[model samples]
Target: MATQLDLQEQEQLDALKAFWKRYGNLVTWLLIAALAAYAGWNGWNYWQRDQALKASAMYDELDRAAAAGDADKTARIFGDLKDRYPGTAYAEQGGLAAAKVQFEKGQVDAAKASLTWVAANAAEDEYRTVARLRLAAVLAAAKQFDQALAELDAAKAAGFEALVADRRGDVLAAAGREAEARAAYEAAYKAMDDSVDYKRLIEAKLTALGAAPAPAAPAASGAAS
Candidate 1:
């Protein structure tokens, strides 16, 4: 019985060795490739996190300079952030902060330039929308009417549609395009929720333009154009 058991054990060992000989090299290479890929992914994640941390620190410095009312420092720090980390959210935030500081200092051209950079290069969609809106406002104030309208027209955020329309109305009114201005004001007024205070302001604008709001339609059987 002992001899029989030894023979059975030897047979099993031989079978295992034969199986390994057939597939061992391929399995070994596959495992090595998988381990290499996992290590590469981890390295990339670590690199991205390190870059983001550094970008965030630079943004904090830019914010501090702006808070202290040092436009020159803000500008220099923001430029550094943009150059090193243009794809980081922190860089876009710095651009907005720099533009605000510049605007406060009556540097309209500089503010516009910063906003334009953010609008074009922001890594986040929301930040890009904000930059475009602020840039449009500055252009409107500068009486760059066509450029302001083009900016507003290119802005496509549903949440910002009403505000863009209102600003467009303002620009049109300034340009003495009374009819287009009235239409834009009407669109803004209709888009705003009834309970919003800004709705009242838009209504006032319509009133001032000698453009009365259209009467409410009956609940049923809506009129066709």
Candidate 2:
């Protein structure tokens, strides 16, 4: 019985050895691949965190420059942030913030350049839409009506159609296209929810264009019991 048990154990050991001989290299390679992937993931995460920290610091500096009303400094810091960490949210926010300062300081061309970069390169759709909308306003102010309209045409983000329509109306009105402007305003008014206070502003725009929406009819009075 002892001899029989030993023979069985030896057979089991031999079978394990044969399996290892056949699959050892494959198992080793799979383990190495998994470990390499895990390391790569950890490295990527660390890099992203490092980038965000640096970008946050730069954005704070940009904010200080903007607050001091130093458009040139704001633009310079924003440019550095964008160049070094374009993938960070700080870069996009800095672009928008820098453009606002530049525009307020009458640096229209610089503002336009910053907005154009954000419009073309912001990772978030909403940021891109905002950049395009602001760029259109700048273009319209410059009397570049066709380019303003083109920018509006490109501001097509989900949930922003109404705003795009409203801005289009403003651009058309600036361009002396009253009829088209009125139509765009009407579309914007119709798209807005009744509860939205912004709808009233759109309504005022429509009224200014001689296209005020009709007031809802009053509910019929009920007879007293």
Candidate 3:
């Protein structure tokens, strides 16, 4: 019986060897591929985190430059950040910050360029909307009324409807189109929550234009910026 058990164990061992002989190379290659894929996935995740960390640091530098009011330095570092890490949220944020500095420094064209980048490529929808609104404001300040109007009209988010209307009113008022301005102001008034002090301002705007302010409704939070 011991000899029989020994033979059974040896037979099992021999069968396993035969199976390995038949499929060992395929199994080994599959295991290697799986390990390589796992390693690649880990490497990619690490690289992404490393990139985000680097981008955050660069953005901090950009913020410092902005605080110092060095438009040139801010622009250069912002450009570097955008170019090197365009996909990072920090890059879009840097664009917004740099645009503000450029605008305050009276660099309209530079600010427009930065804002355009943020509008076009920002990863966050909120950032894109803010950039669009700011860009429209700048264009309106430059008296590019049609261009500003086009930007506002093309904006897809309903969240900024009131702000867009308010901006449109400003643009129309700048162009001395009082009737259109009144209409726009009314729209803004209607869109705003009645509780906001800004609604009173809009109402005053309508009164100045000799147009009755639209009846107040519950304010939707649709103001951009």
Candidate 4:
């Protein structure tokens, strides 16, 4: 019985060795792959954190330059920020901030370029929408009516449909397309919520276009008992 037990144990050990010989390289490679992936994930997270810290500091500098009304410095800092950390929210905010300063300083072309970059490359849909809206306004002011309308067309964001329509109306009005302008204003007015103060502005636009939304009809009186 002792000899039989030892033989069984040896057979088990030999079977385990055969299995290892057949699958050892595959198991080793799989473990190496998993470890490499985990390390890469950790490295990527660390790099992103480092980038955000640097971008935040750069954005602070950009904000100061913009606040001081130094359009040139603002543009320069924003350009550097964008080049180094274009994926960061700070870069998007810096672009928008720099554009405002540039626009205020009558650097219309520079402003457009900044806005265009944000419109094209911003990570968030809302930022891109805002950039396009501002770009449209700038283009309209420059009498680039077609380009303005095109920008407005591309400014689609979930909650910004009314604003886009309103901007479209403004661009059409600028281009002397009164009919299209009135239609766009009416659409904007209809889409805006009654509780929004900006809706009142849209109403005013419709009124200006002589297409004021009709007053809600009075509810029918209940039949007399």
TM-score of each: 0.83, 0.94, 0.79, 0.92
RMSD (CA, Å), each prediction = 4.9, 1.7, 6.7, 2.0
For candidate 2, report its TM-score: 0.94
lDDT of each residue in 101-191, candidate 4, tens digit only: 9999999999999999999999999999999999999999999999998898888889999899999999999999999999999888888
TM-score of 3: 0.79
Candidate 1 global TM-score: 0.83
- Superposed model 2: Cα runs more than 4 Å off: 1-8, 219-225
Put down candidate 2 lDDT per residue, 90-196, tens digits, no spaces: 99999999999999999999999999999999999999999999999999999999999999989979999889999999999999999999999989988888888
- Candidate 1 residues 163-211, lDDT tens each? 8899889999988999999999999998888778998899889999998
CA lDDT, every prediction? 0.90, 0.95, 0.90, 0.95
lDDT score for residue 56 of model 1: 93
What is the Å distance of residue 89 in model 3 from its true position?
Answer: 1.2
- Single out the weakest 10-residue window by summed lDDT for candidate 3: 210-219
lDDT of 3 at 96: 95
What would you estimate as the lDDT of candidate 1?
0.90
Model 1 misplaced stretches (Cα beyond 4 Å):
1-19, 212-225
Clash tally for model 3: 2
Q: Cα miss at 173, model 3 (Å)?
A: 2.1
Displacement of residue 95 (Cα, Å) in model 2 is 0.6
lDDT tens digits by residue: candidate 3, 1-225: 579889999999999999999999999999999999999999999999999999999999999999999999999999999999999999999999999999999999999999999999987778888888899899989989899888777666756788779888988898888889888888888898867898888888888888865464776888798
